[model samples]
Target chain A: MSGTPNQGPGLRYPSNKKSIYDRNLNRTKNAELSRAAFAYLFIEMIAYAQRGVSNVGDLEQKLNTQGYPIGLRLLDLLLSRSSNPLASIRPTRILPLLQFIAQTLYRHLFGRPADALEKSSTEPGQYMLFDNEPMVSQYVSLPRELSSLNCAAFVAGVIEGVCDGAGFPTEGVTAHSVGEQEQGKDAKAMWPDKTVFLIKFKPEVLEREEILGRGGG
Target chain B: MVVFALMIISKSGGLIYNREFHTGLSKLTSNDYLILAGSFHGMHAITSQLSPAPRIPYITPQNNMLAPSPFPNRPTGIEVMESSHFRLQCFQTQTGTKFLLVTEPQQPNVDTMMKKVYELYADYVMKNPFYTVEMPIRCEKFDRGLDGFIKVRG
Candidate 1:
């Protein structure tokens, strides 16, 4: 510190003498984190969230909360990364936003677009984003007591965050193990961890969409 | 061609980030900045509504077939406000967060500069876990990134 005159009085520099500010955001664009390392960290995160939880639903909610900010952060980061700054455009409508999440956000996080995206026929404002195999919960095996809990609630939280960050406020986003219901016994046996994220937008969002669609804006 | 200042407004019309790079313009109190952001947000909304409707919808040639353009005709509000002294260029994200850049009247490529600013905001400010949504920005990395970018480009 004494040898460097430009150094701040109380600031400490790492051996590399580079701060997060000095690093390029795109440096990790094509980089892949080790799956084992990620799994370890994720296990720790789940363990932390599990403490003092009374029920499985509460535990899932806690996990969801933990992933919410991540979704918010990724919303802008991925948007900036996806397009040329000169000709960049963000999704303003419902379908485009869902497509962005189903395609861009999925690929960025899981190395591929989601398996399917479907608007719920029974509900006007509800949509379903499907992942044939959720990477986060692949290694997670819930005991018989907690079989009702789907660890993919964290991913659902992330989806909720993305929707909320994009200005399409959702009523809530929840994850369910839909493999059993949607598939035959053979299919379910093949991919037991298949999950679906149900995204229900707020009524105001649908109203705005209706107006915008009518106005062609 | 000199850059002057930058202001960021949240979707709810709050001045979330404000910084001055050059010293040419008159200084205003922090309260004035809040008012500026709020009024600017309102003005932007009004300008979009005030825009004249396009007489014909945009069409595109797709697979050798003429089809209506997929892009929505959302009216972008006040994009550039120019005056004798400085030019105020605004870039509004789809989420309605506005980035305002004040530059010298003759400055070129202000849009590119604004984009860089947005990128910095996305990386340093948004990614920082401490940052609350729609709150005033106080990220050290963001400040450093902005300063470095302006020093290089300006």
Candidate 2:
């Protein structure tokens, strides 16, 4: 093992110029993606889902699962992309993570923030993440066998993972298809398939959910 | 146009899907639907064989393909049904997979709708790791997509 400067996998960072972290995070924003790139990427994503799913539901879940990593990666990417980016991506509290996911991640993926993040009235450990429509499963269909499965569960898993990774242990996350009404159709009345990603925290997460929920009350 | 319902039948023509959208059309017995699929399958094979021998289209004079021409003037293996309520169009993918769509006959862009349904089938139904081909197709994503597409257009 020659002790050469350019050889071997050692903890060597870039020298000379300012390190990436040394620069103000706000400096890096407004990267552009070509429309065709997004279209092709989305098409390939659909094709990948198509070739892998055993059923419609499984496919959607796969898409959601795919998005989960994006969500996780987005948590940091958005910060790095932020006009006023953070110095070190320190999500000291759960609220910031959810906000980043709902706003930063949502806008990055859907061109807008999620509609809302609400607590389930019945379930104490549960929180609902809302979107008018989920993009990944936008054109998916679930077969009969998967009538009970929720593809959004993948998103839920992602959120849970993020939460857990960030010192917030959580239970399972589930996506419940809640229908949307438009185009002269009462989608909710007939088809309640709008996805509501249920984020159920672990006992620890529940404690935090309570701590967060009891902000005023 | 709104896509009301879609059914995928096996090569044997077994009913693999029986979903409803907006308003499902008249109900047929599950057994009857299976019979219908099988009968339709039998008819499809005959029609495909009966399709005139692949006369090489002037477009492809080279005749590069050794096997029977993929572009035989074969019937698309598509069928349709119409009632005052809705029009049903059957579309077959290149892989001999079938997609039946129920929509309003007067719908301006039914073809696009059918194509989208086919796309959804390929995406959600085909890509699902848990899904097994040549068996029942049960997927939640497919249903959600159908619900959204129909809800928006219908």
Candidate 3:
């Protein structure tokens, strides 16, 4: 889906340059992957994370760390594909930035917009991202010791990655169960039905959120 | 391939899954469903224990619950649900986690479905950093995949 970059069309740019556009050619339409391979890979990832860590947070941090680089890389890649390309994520305000993250980043990561974007009524600078069924946690059931942690921390890491990759600064992203506490309220969160991604910002983001609030762009 | 029905039972015999992919199987109450899972789990356990071979007396050194599965190579707990029109293939993970796939009696292949379910579990729930093992499954991807997979199979 790569169109010619802003350098304009038809003026032969570096033919051998490693652009995202160049890489899209390799993904054939019928490049179906074997599920077994993915399972083994994921299994190995869990096994590896289990090593050298005594606590669940440490293990999840490891996973989140693993996904961070990919997130950062994807940020630039996704923007490059956009028509205006956001020009380095200048959201200028919290609302714009949050909308961009929930809409753009979610699309980049999950192939669709997030199920919902919300702000905590009681708290400012706290944002929540909702996903009815996070694809990453489909077959998993975690031990109780780490139930408070969200594996989508990896997704949070990715969002963190993208935010950090851009000029915007951020704090850690944590995953939570936003699923209805009662069953049948919405059966989706029954096991891991809903994922509430908590995006805490760095103080700088708050500072910027205010500065931008006063037309200080 | 067509999977006719599927069910999941927790280690404690709680009915965690009850799905009918084919019309052959009869529906029952939630309590009956729990009873069915407990009965099957008991039967499976009994069959394993009462195999013709004598029970090999063995003592463990203790404190090794996570030891490599003793039944790794042996035919572990899994079976087929047979009915007039279809077969329900069952697969249980080594961690006592089980998956049931309902398929047409004459379906050619089911290895892919089982593997795919496990894969989705790993990605959506296990990888979910939020999921805790050995508890109930609540991840949406797993449910969605199960629904989609069975719908097409049916």
RMSD of each: 27.6, 9.3, 12.9
What does candidate 1 score on TM? 0.54
| Candidate 3: CAPRI quality band | incorrect
Candidate 2 is graded, for docking, as: incorrect
Model 1: colliding residue pairs: none
Model 1, residue A6: distance off in Å is 4.2
Count steric clashes of candidate 2. Answer: 37
CA lDDT scores, all candidates in order:
0.84, 0.65, 0.67
**TM-score for each of the candidates:** 0.54, 0.53, 0.54
Order candidates by TM-score, high to low: 1, 3, 2
Task: Evaluate candidate 3 by giving its C-alpha RMSD to the native, one decimal.
Answer: 12.9
Higher-DockQ candidate among 1 and 3? 3
User: What is the per-residue lDDT of model 2 for residues B4-26, given as tens digits with 9 covering 90 to 100?
Assistant: 66678775567788676655457
DockQ of 2: 0.18
Q: Write the per-residue lDDT of candidate 3 for residues B36-75, one digit (tens) a residue.
A: 7788788777765665554554647674455664664444
Error of 3 at A144 (Å): 5.1
**Model 1 error, position B14 (Å):** 63
